[model samples]
Target chain A: MITIALPKGALLSDSIELFKRLGLDFTAFLDSKNRQLQITDPTNTAKGLLVRATDVPVYVEYGQAQLGIVGYDLLLEKTPDVAHLADLNFGGCRMSVAVPKTSPYQTPTELPPNGKVASKFVNCAKTYFQQLDLPVEIIPLYGSVELGPITGMSEAIVDLVSTGRTLKENGLVEVDTLFQSTARLIAHPLSYRLNLDNLNDLGEQIKNSVSKS
Target chain B: MITIALPKGALLSDSIELFKRLGLDFTAFLDSKNRQLQITDPTNTAKGLLVRATDVPVYVEYGQAQLGIVGYDLLLEKTPDVAHLADLNFGGCRMSVAVPKTSPYQTPTELPPNGKVASKFVNCAKTYFQQLDLPVEIIPLYGSVELGPITGMSEAIVDLVSTGRTLKENGLVEVDTLFQSTARLIAHPLSYRLNLDNLNDLGEQIKNSVSKS
Candidate 1:
């Protein structure tokens, strides 16, 4: 039996829908009141575990769940040991560098030497600045990295830019895009090696469905 | 004028109540729909900046807000360069080491050498185990640390424990407490030094009200 971990909130519906197209009946697992962390599918050949989006890769890497769906931003941030099977192409966003709209530091070079750049994705920010050969401080913030620049805590912020509404409202403007992100289907290395045929079939089905949609 | 950063959710009410006792009217700032991140009192002698609980210390440490009310757990995790003023004593919890209820490792030492301990507080967990003279792997998880042991990602977890219901439900048990935690008042170094008299007066008012309550 193959167990899959699905992120609970915004990504849940899309994951379930994708699985359904692959002939997997995951409806019972979607019941809001179930409250059960683990639920067995009607066929009992697969199980679903609801978890926080960021923890999806952790579960897959540990082999608790053979498969998972998570955002690419998380993959860049944590860099967990998991096989990046296929891009599901949903939950699209861009990881970008932002600064307060009123800041004098518009370009990356304009930033003061060794000025701090706050972000939830500390690793991503580090890599981005390193690629630019810029030595800057990365201040890790769990939420609202937009407020970092607005409050002068950091000269700039590296965070996900979706519709740009959040940054605009926070008086921040996107300055540089680090990466384009979407949800990806990931699997444990051991699981992929052992159940190659079944997992590949599942992966192929998801890719076909996603392309058609 | 004095600027204070208050956490947005559970701790907001208690923080406002504490400030009100000092004759600082902060009710208008408490409205959930205000959308304005910064709001001033009617008299303009003080202003409130509502921010995510986890970012409270960041604002204060950066001098964006002179003072902040935040959980002690965050303070331990971040170790910001801020004055640890009076312990507000609310939001009480413990940073605990937990493992599967059935795990054979009863004590921290009984666990396999070089075993992993997962937690959102990566730095805190690393420091705790390092002090125990254990060579343990620290897996940084953003949420659901209980799943670490259940999924075999880590032999144990270090996380915040309040009611222990979450752990119990996940078939995990607390093994040891790293530290006892509560909400605290933190201030930037320069702010405390510059506004020494006013800050002390505010701290005294809060301490008095806390004792009376």
Candidate 2:
């Protein structure tokens, strides 16, 4: 049976809906009381493994899941060895460089050369700064990137800004946008090539579903 | 006023209680409705920054906070340069190497050489295997590591076993333990030395409270 790794957060409901259109019912994962990480569709056609968004690529890369749905931002940061199948286009957000609204700096270039920047996406932050020929220290923070500026630990933060509410409420403003992000469909390279468990047909169907949606 | 960094999860309440013993009330952070990440104690004597467990050390190291409470496992993994003040002793757990109950492996050495061991504590895993002279690939997973072996992503997982309930529910069994972990009090090195804002005195008071408890 083809197993699909589904991301657990913002993209979850839509991912389940997409699969539901394909006649696979894995929505049991959406139940608040459901603690099971791995569940099989009622039709016994495919299985779903609910995992963290960042881990979707890892499972697909290891061939544990023939296909997975993840964020485009994660694809860029992790660069996992998986086939880029399609862009599902939901869960839209942008990777942005933000600074305290009260700060005089208005853009990434205006920031001090050696200033500290905090982000969960350290790799993306490093690449963005490097491409600008800017030298800044990237402090990796696992949570509360918005607090970076408030606490004075960092001059700026590179984070995903979906509604600008989080930034606005935290007294921060977007200094520069790195890139837009949305949900992406990925498949294991070998699994895709071999058409394991009729994965090609399912992939094509999902792509059609995405195009229509 | 001295600023203290408190971790957000499991250790939060205990940490708040610890500070209350120091004559500071940061219980507002315990309210479910409170979205504030940074809060000043009722008396304005000190401020608290609620951050992820791993980020606690970063805040203290950068002196954004003169003191912080975090897990010892994080201290071992990140090796942040901060003064290890005292062990608060709450939130006890241990890092252990666990494998599927059905697996033949009985210990870390019994696992295949060059096999994958998934964990969030990659450095600690690396160091443990290196000391044991076992070569294993440490796959850094950010969440739900208990699913590692179940998904066939790794031969075993090195994770913090709190109640062993998670491991049991996942059909995993602990094979070898790395070390015990508990909440630890940490302070900025320079802040502690110079008694910045009487941080030395506060540290002593906390130590006394911990000892009495």
Which ten residues in a row are the worst by lDDT in model 2 chain B?
B105-114
Candidate 2 to truth, TM = 0.97
Query: Which candidate achieves the best TM-score against the true structure?
Result: 2
Worst lDDT window (10 residues) for model 1 chain B?
Answer: B196-205
Residue A193's lDDT within candidate 1 is 81
lDDT of 1 at B161: 90
- Count the clashes in each prediction: 0, 0
Against the true structure, candidate 1 has what lDDT?
A: 0.84
Candidate 2 Cα outliers beyond 4 Å, as residue runs: none
- Report model 1's TM-score to 2 decimal places: 0.90
Candidate 2 lDDT, A25-104, residue by residue in tens: 99899899998999999999999999999989999998999999999999999999999999998999999999998897
State the displacement of the C-alpha of residue A39, model 2, in Å, after optimal TM-score superposition.
1.6
Question: What tens digits encode model 2's per-residue C-alpha lDDT throughout B102-135?
Answer: 9988788999996999999999999999999988
Tens digit of per-residue lDDT, candidate 1, span B1-213: 678899987788889888887777788767756677777877776788888888898788878888899989899888888888888878888999998889999788787887988999999898888888899988777677787887677999999899999999999888899999988998888978887438766766777888788
